[model samples]
Target chain A: MIEVRNLCKHYGARKAVDDISFTVNDGEIVGFLGPNGAGKTTTIRILTCYHPATSGSARVAGFDVLSQSIQVRRHVGYLPETVPLYPEMRVREFLRFRGKLRGLARGERETCIARVTERCWLGEVVDRPISQLSKGYRQRVGLADALLHNPRVLILDEPTVGLDPTQIRETRSLIRELTRDHTVILSSHILPEVEATCGRIVIINRGRVVASGTPQELRSRRGDGAVHAEVRAPVEEALQAVRELANGAKVTADAADGWTRLRVEATGDLREPIYRLSTQRGWTLRELRRDAGSLEDFFVRIVAEAQMQAPQ
Target chain B: MRATVAIMQRELLSMFCTPIGYVVIAGFLLILGVLVILTEGFEPGQPATLRNAFGLMPFILAFVVPAIAMRALSEEYRSGTIEGMMTAPISDAQLVLGKFLGSAAFYAVMLGTSLVYPILMQVYGSPDWGAVLSTYIGLLLIGLFFLSVSIFTSSFSSNQIIAWITASVVLASFAVGGFLLVRHVGGFWRQLIQRANVMGRFEESALGLFTTGSVVCFGALAGLFLFLTIKVVESRRWR
Candidate 1:
């Protein structure tokens, strides 16, 4: 489990991570969603003990990030944004070196190396130098390096920032599989990537959290229910009836080839009301449905809203 | 300590894994050989001593030691591997000490190869084993001093060339640069300059002199730089 409270990191006079607070429970796969320069990387670095916060506190795996940083580091596996790696060393060599640095004994190092190699699909390229591997393979090697010690928390910064679609799919599946053993906290700007992979999402803008919830919850909370209806009644009557039910919802109606099409947009689910109204009016009901707004739109809107509230 | 050794091995691994390590050793040995031969260290008529060889170190080490130590931390910074290294369970002291020891060990090997000269001299001339041992010990101590300064400078920038230049300029101030001011000044200032002079200490110790004061002085300076490097590294976490 990871708990962060009022975490602030400043570089000179600029606030990189400005008083952000959140938590990730055990067996949870959380996505840190943010735009560029939104302090995603800075927060990750602080959590990994790469840098200390200017004020506030963070604890990882029951150890404080500042006072118990060594213990925190021991339990944390970090894959940085750029996938920092030694280019000359072979995959196995690099893993062994990292395992040794992580204080793994000889036998444990080899076994850990083998386990990660197998888990991360690094078996075929274990003998090749890191420079020779493709970008996807290099990313896997970085992930393998992080997994060498079986850390309690796996913190990945933009785990799939640069990859082909197929590789992205593969990596997403691998991350999902890893959620069984590790409390995974990954940061990404890609909306669908997080929507598809993570169980919970924390969206940040201007170094502060704009919103946090599951993908379904964020969509439902931000995007009120809008119903689309097709009725054989007159366009004016259909519009008035839906407008009366919607009570200030943006209702529109138009007649197209003998059918009145009505749209009712409001803060709550209006589909059932529209269906009952269409059936009671003795009109032939044709179509009634609602489209859930994509997380992309919600992400853009909240981030823009946050920006307007606190102008930089 | 185990982490320190692990880092030291990685340091050595990076150095020897490239051709630069071999090239440097060969070049330093060849240059030292030519310089010793050009002087009369092996001449039958001259005294059988290694004073001339040890005398050349401050000048050569002012260039070569930094060349060897320049990339230790600088490359890690430039390549972004420092993020990985700093986040590991090891302390900053282990990281700094490991890199310093690795470069010093490489210097030991480079300096060890030059022992061929005394062996050749032993074929006919009775080279003073006391001066030989003291000279080697003195050079290694100075090498530690040089490696610490160079590694400290390596932490100053991500550019290896900049690190090399910074280390060279700082070391030159003690080895050669300080002498220019020492001649013009008198009394305490000159005494202070002479007291910390690397070339002067090596020259004195090259004549079979191994005083506790000399060891303490060089050892303290090396320790100071190592401590400073650790501080600079630790400061990164704050920034």
Candidate 2:
């Protein structure tokens, strides 16, 4: 469980993490979605107590990150962006070192290392030096280090950043499995990955929380029954006919490669009306499909537009 | 405290795990051994003493310790591993002291190898065993001070090259005290500058004087640098 309120980190006049706040319930997997320099890492750093918040409070597992950082650190395992690893250390040794730092006893340290090694699929490379491991294995080694102590909460920054597709999927599944027991908060710029992995998302733009909800909830709320249609007709003629026929429907139109494309936002589904109109007008309806509202679409529409306006 | 020990142990293992430790130790011993032998050949009646061995170490440490300590905290910053280490359940003081002690312990081992010089002298001629032992104590203290300085410099920059250069400059300033450049200064200014002679303190201690002042001076120098290193590391988290 984690709580953050009015968290702001300012480097002189620039606000790396402006007024951002969110909470995660026990056993919940929350994705922190943002673009580059969107203060996702700054917010995570504050929660992990790696940096003091300029003016805010963050609590982890009922312990205040500022006043009780040691306790908070005891409960949370953080895998920072770039995966901080000592190159000369072996995977097993690194995990054991992390276990001890988390205050596990000798036998417990070994047991924890073994458990995480198996869980994160690091057994084969356990004896290999970190420098010798590939990017995916090194990333897993970082994950194993974080999971070694069996902490109640996991904060991972870009957990699957550079992994191959297979490794990414495996890590996503591993993260999903982690939620069966521990609270998870991970930051990523990959929208589909977050949608596939996280139960809820806190979308940040320009160092501020612009939207927060489940993936479907955000998609549906931002939706107004919009559909993208590609008609095989003269661009102006197609636009004129659609605009005149659909009386009150709003359309954002564009043409590419001689195909007339229009994004129509209607109060209700207009597939049947558009199909009838195309038939009557002898217009070839090349593609007429309801736009599948995805997290990527929702994210780009909201945060990207917001950033363009404010320049923060 | 436990976390600090964990970090210290890992660092110790890492030093030996790589060739960094072996190279520094081997290079130091070989050069110091040859220096001792060269001095014996040059001044046959001057009596072989660790004074010559310890005398050259400040120059050796000017480079060797920097190589060892350049990556202490700098590598963590460069690789972004400091985030993991700092966010662990340990206080800044513990991390600082643990790293300081770990590197100091390595320096101790490096200094330990030079004991062969004193032992060789004792076998060949009658050297002052007290002075020889005292000189070694002085060298260890100087090594610790240099290690602390290098570590502190390492904390200031993520680039190892920058850390090494900064540490070299700081150590050189201290090592080049009263003798080298002070003659260029006025009498009063020269005396003031002489007080900056860190190695001069070792010279007194090596004379078998056992002055509490010299020990205190080296202790304070190490303490100051260690404190500065901690402050630099802590500042990075907030900014």
Candidate 3:
């Protein structure tokens, strides 16, 4: 539903987004992951047609963002980081205004407003002024406004910034449900929300894409395949036995309360060798687990590697 | 066109939902009432006309119109609503025209309420209906011209107070400074200043002299400023 090719945006001497390219398929929820100032918002703004790219091109829903912006805008719904809303307007009135601006007919606007209000769970405050609502409610209203026209693409920037735990969970579930129909591109710094809601992840740093894949694929590709084991035995004996069993593996061991834990960073499976060593020594093996990298770990490693490769 | 109308409706609704619109209109009427009715000495037996009322409108409008228009785009920028509007499907021209018309409609209401002055004149004495109509036309033209200037300045700054000050300085420079400069200069400079002075064009209609030259001048200036406002808004996409 969205494609960007070598998109470059420069504000004077600084490049906000530089030579970044990505494609999102229909009905796919792509999580845009980046730390602050990683050009995530800048890329989304260009795709939404709010700003022009200094070089290269982007298209949303098959409409060129530069030349055919109006059509692109018509097919895409955007919710900016600040949730741009007029506080004086009631929730229903604001939705109606957005609907009319999107070129919906009077009857269609009425029905769409009702539908979105219900979908976003904004029925209780539909008649009240938006300024009187809480931050979570306002965020929902912003989401409701984006869904009012039922566009083919929904682009949200930091959708769960200020919400409480429950609201964040609700927003995550809502976004997950939206993947059934709409193609969503959302940027957020919260890794867990992206892990819980998005089907795929694209991590960018310093105006470039550092990694892009499914969470599992990324974890496997970047993971070091480390093994961790806990044994109830003499600390020095257990450590010496495991180190000898796993040849040429970096091992670190700690002991407390008649128990010792060992962490082995190895290129291959060390669990079987360690288990055999424990059985031979008559040591009680309490736990043995292989570590698959987490999204947070992957994100941090990718971003750190990018920073190291970046020119000073 | 439908998009323009929707934006205009939203703008107008937002303006009235706040206290600013009502306060501006009420203050304008109260000041005009005091200046034209109570302070300007008129004998009981003398013929009554709206000359005093029309004479004082330009000076008041120079400040008041900008106050009404200062928030048009500045508030949008301050609240980040401009991002939403720009990302919508509407064209920059449509957005500019929508905001201009919304503010213009509010100004019209303010002017409409002042018609009671002429109605009182008609009841107490015989006033020239032609002059009254022409004076109103001239006032509307001036209001539009000032509003265009205000909108341009508003687009340049996100701070409402800064927008108001910039607009006031620009309008006052043209309306008052031109006449002041004309007094010190001679020959071509004097004629140039007189021709460009907005106050002189406004006074021509108030004195029952409705010339095509003045109408075209006001129309052209208003169009120029509005066009400039649109350009500023369009240029924002690059920045």
Q: What DockQ does every candidate get?
A: 0.69, 0.68, 0.85
Second chain of candidate 3: TM-score? 0.94
Instruction: Report model 3's TM-score to 2 decimal places.
Output: 0.94
Off by over 4 Å in 2: A226-292, B41-48, B179-197
- By DockQ, rank the candidates, best first: 3, 1, 2
Candidate 1 residue lDDT tens string, B1-239: 77788778878887888877898898788788888887878787898776776687678888889999999999999999999998888888889988988888788888888898889889878988988998888888888999999999999899999999999898877787666888999999899988887777887778888888789989999999999999999997786
Residue-wise C-alpha lDDT for candidate 3, range A90-145, written one tens digit per residue:
99889988888889999999999989999999989999999999999999999998
Give stretches of model 3 more than 4 Å off. A267-281, B38-42, B181-195
Ranked candidates (TM-score, high to low) = 3, 1, 2
**Least well predicted 10-residue stretch by lDDT in candidate 1 chain A:** A220-229
Model 3 CAPRI rating: high
Task: For residues A78-185, write the lDDT of model 2, one tens digit per residue.
Answer: 898889888998887888888777789999888888888899988789999999999999999888888887889999999999999999999999999999989999
Report lDDT (CA) for all predictions: 0.89, 0.84, 0.89
Alpha carbon lDDT of residue A24, candidate 2? 89
Tell me which of candidates 1 and 3 scores higher on DockQ: 3
Candidate 1 regions exceeding 4 Å error are A229-248, A254-261, A267-288, B40-50, B123-126
Candidate 3: lDDT of A279? 89
Sorted into a CAPRI-style docking class, model 1 comes out as medium
Report the lDDT tens digits of candidate 3 across residue range B67-161. Answer: 88898899999999998999999999999999999899888988999898788777777888999998999899889999999999999999999
Q: Tell how far residue A278 is off in model 1, in angstroms.
A: 7.0
Scored against the true structure, residue A58 in model 2 reaches a CA lDDT of: 88
Cα TM-score of candidate 1: 0.93
DockQ score of candidate 1? 0.69
